[model samples]
Target: MGLSSRSAVAIHALTMLARWSDKSLTSAEIADSLASNPVLVRRILGSLRDADLVRSTEGRGGGWLLARAAREITLHDAYTAVEAGPVLSRHPHPPSDACEVGRNMQALLEAEFQDAERAMEERLSQTTIADLVQQVLTIERKIGRSAR
Candidate 1:
């Protein structure tokens, strides 16, 4: 029915990872930055790990790291890795068949939804975590905040 914040969080976490590629970061650390729960961050990280977008380690000085360069990962890639649901979904049951509008509404909406989704995917494909990181840092600098 609606979009989820998982994709946003994934992108944010990835941007941080990209910015600090020299060191690994624990779920708690990421959670702190996102103002979210460590468990939730861990869960999200698990999904990213499964998607091969991130790697994790345990024990002393262990944490998560990007599987590859930020430039190699796109917003669309992050969106898919989280298994976010479709941008649009139909009603559970068809509307009344007796109604002319109801009978063709789904078909009409489906086509439009597909086109919208394709357009969104195309735009996402053009952006990367590194790009987002750069934007964030630029804004921070403009606001007189250190980008660390």
Candidate 2:
């Protein structure tokens, strides 16, 4: 199943915050970098805040920051924070009970999907926000821009 754009955006925002650990980043600034709307950025940040992935501040010199160390945050955690439902949704149609394949396919599909999701989670758990941030920084350096 494909992940929603919100998940991607939230992960990017978190990675950006991790890279800029010394300073907070406003939604406007993040939007500029992501080429997205500031309001959307705020909405994504709001969700992250609720998940305790990020913390926000008001007033001047205020914005958002990672709630904890980047190394402690996994991609699966970010996905779980933004995803609305199961990673892979199945069709609701009841297979023809008369057929053995149809009668058993649902269970098979469910098992397969669960296994796939577990594998994905395992892979994601191995990589943290800190890893993503470092990759981004490396790309920025290769392009001759400071990874702010």
Candidate 3:
């Protein structure tokens, strides 16, 4: 199980907001940079807004902005905001009652999947939007595209 593009887009939007620091970004602007539809940006923004990771404005000079400092936001926070289901999917097998292995396998699989998800969440919780922004800036600098 890999994360969806929505995860990448959410991370990018947050990183951009962090880099801008004081400026709000319109969905159009974020869509342009992310090479995705503005509607898609808005959808992701809606989830972020619900999570209190971002705040939206209306009318002129309006857009979206990070609701808090980047350092306070973890990747797991973002993931949790958008995650609709389990991190890993399990196969649904209706085992025969007479089969000993099949009858017990489902429980075992669920336990293993839960453990994996916990481990993944733990790792994600350790990284913040600030960390992602720093890595992105480093790459931009290495490629001579630093904002300076």
Largest TM-score belongs to which candidate? 1
Which residue pairs overlap in candidate 1's backbone? none
Q: Could you report the Cα RMSD, in angstroms, for every candidate shown?
A: 1.2, 1.8, 2.0
Better lDDT candidate (2, 3): 2
* Candidate 1 lDDT tens digits, 1-148: 5588898889888988898899999988899899999998988888999999999988999999999999999999998888666777767798988999999998998899889999999999999998998898899989999845
Error of 1 at 59 (Å): 1.4
TM-score-best of 1 and 2: 1
lDDT of each: 0.90, 0.89, 0.87
List residue ranges in candidate 2 displaced over 4 A.
none
lDDT of 1 at 146: 87
Model 1 TM-score (2 dp)? 0.95
lDDT of 2 by residue, 6-40 (tens): 88898889988998989999999999889999999
As a whole number from 0 to 100, the lDDT of residue 80 in candidate 3 is 85
What is the TM-score (0 to 1) of candidate 3? 0.91
- Candidate 1, which ten residues in sequence have the lowest lDDT sum? 83-92
